[model samples]
Target: MSQLPKRIIKESQRLISDPVPGITAVPHEDNLRYFQVTIQGPKESPYQDGLFKLELYLPDDYPMVAPKVRFLTKIYHPNIDRLGRICLDVLKKNWSPALQIRTILLSIQALLSAPNPDDPLSNEVAEHWKRDEQDAIATAKEYTKLYATEQ
Candidate 1:
């Protein structure tokens, strides 16, 4: 691979040294652009008490294009598909070059706190959420308990 970008290196260092609260991102030794991330579910949300894992990859054009982030741990959210693709504007159309990995991850965390069923990646889940929000929250909590618990 070519020399790693200075910005990526700086971002990686800062992620380690000044980690975000309830979040941890660590780069692979051989692949600095790939990160193993863990996020603590926000309190009062269905995902609360769960620790969700995710993979984040910065493409060559990173910052110019949004990073590719997907949940590694299973979660039941209207905006997150079965394959773990998230439906968030900042990760797509609303992305800006000025945004950093930390901010992106924070946005994902916020998504957990407030899921948008109206604009969803998982239609089935969205329908369920729309039909019965309480039941949907229960299912989300169940999935989080079953899949996101730390070993």
Candidate 2:
């Protein structure tokens, strides 16, 4: 058996032991470095009841380097671009060694609740959110119903 990195193995164990509410991370059976995550939308948010999938890749130099994360599910949000890239400070410049997978997923869930218009990945969505909060929220709800809802 290929020996996995200590950090990755420990992180995986922690995720399994103390899972974040509404979020699950399962490592690929073939590759321990890659993980699949599913995060449920926060209650009462426009994305409520939605289940979003994401793929996470932990580099060999983890803790020093942040994991690569991308949404596998299509989502309409100001901070999420068309390609599913997220614009969150914590994922980038603000990342700290103290942060873990559960914390990252929780931050993402919070992002769905309160989008950051100041720094938006989707300009049109940001503009809509800035100009008309109600309309933007309504549209988000519609998207949740249409694209995010399980068939």
Strongest candidate by lDDT: 1
What is the C-alpha local distance difference test score of each model?
0.96, 0.88
Candidate 1 Cα misplacement greater than 4 A, ranges:
none
lDDT of 1 at 48: 99
Clashes of each: 0, 0
lDDT by residue (66-101, candidate 2, tens digit) is 788888888889999888899988899999978887
* Alpha carbon lDDT at 51, candidate 2: 86
The residue ranges of model 2 lying beyond 4 angstroms of the native Cα positions read none
lDDT of 1 by residue, 25-88 (tens): 9998889899999999999999999999999999999989999999999999999999899999
Q: Can you give the lDDT of residue 140 in candidate 2?
A: 87
**What are the clashing pairs of model 1?**
none
RMSD of each: 0.7, 1.4
Candidate 1 displacement at residue 107 in angstroms:
0.2
Cα displacement (angstroms), candidate 1, residue 44, comes to: 0.5
Could you estimate the TM-score for every candidate? Answer: 0.98, 0.94
